[model samples]
Target: MTGKMLRGMVITLVLAGGLAACANDPSITDTIDTRSAPDGMKTVGVCYNGNNTTRAAVSEIALKACPKGTTKLKLWDKDHMANACPLTKVNRVVFLCLH
Candidate 1:
């Protein structure tokens, strides 16, 4: 290929990669519902913009919602098709807190 064409392709690739790298940078919303389950258990709903959100970020947010005496969190359900959240959050992750 010509030098000009190669340069153009390189520039395009760089820009695309930059945009893709930012896919996981969107804000996430955590909704905690204690009444959803019985005592000693709680449900956490996470709303995210993209599917690229890191697992660590999601786990951190859920753990923060745990009660004062919570020992660990048991993942009761994780439903991607559950559109309980609005905005750009297409997936719904439900974590059940255990004390």
Candidate 2:
């Protein structure tokens, strides 16, 4: 191939690679919020990365939020929006742990 054609191809390849990297970037943010608990219920918030967050992983975090002897009443995400437990691979997982 001519030098000009080769240069153009290289630039195209580089741009494509950059776009792909951005598309697959894992911009996950996990957090825990305990400010919304009811009068008697203790609540905690947890966030996990979407690429590796699993139900088991979330449960483990929730189990740690509450005291050992306390009863776990519910485990949900942000205002009980998600009904599923051990949530899917999401960009942000905001779990509310209640005891």
Candidate 3:
């Protein structure tokens, strides 16, 4: 391959990597509801630092720990938990973000 073509590919790869890194970085803001599904369903909200991959892993753990037929689990918020998912024994709960 030509030098110019190789350089272009390298630059593209670098830029793509940087963009992905930026995308993975989570932003924190207080919200009323953190559940991916905002419904009457019992929802557990944890403090998500925008790490979707880790969050999914954590969620896998939660699902095993939680009771059957429970779906709503998310990054935690104290008030939301008290009000929303209190009756949700099946609601998988976790706080303190993990990398």
Quick one: best TM-score, which candidate? 1
**In candidate 1, what are the lDDT values of residues 1-99, reduced to their tens digit?**
999999999999999898765544433344453235666456777655555777677777777766777677776655554555654456657677776
Q: What overall lDDT goes with each candidate model? A: 0.64, 0.50, 0.44
Order of candidate numbers by TM-score, starting with the best: 1, 2, 3
Query: Candidates 2 and 3: which is better by TM-score?
Result: 2
Clashing pairs in 1: none
Looking at model 2, residue 87 earns an lDDT score of: 36
Judge candidate 3 at residue 83 and give its lDDT. Answer: 34
| Residue 2, model 2, lDDT | 100
- Give TM per candidate: 0.53, 0.41, 0.35
Model 2: residues with Cα > 4 Å off, grouped in runs: 1-35, 79-99
Candidate 3 clashing pairs?
A: 45-75, 45-76, 46-74, 46-75, 46-76, 47-76
| Models ranked on lDDT | 1, 2, 3
Per-residue alpha-carbon lDDT of candidate 3 for residues 37-75, written as tens digits (9 for 90 to 100): 334433333332332436565466445444566555545
**Greater-lDDT candidate between 1 and 3:** 1
Tens digit of per-residue lDDT, candidate 2, span 1-99:
999999999999999988765544332233333235445554545544446546676666666765566555364444333422233323333444443
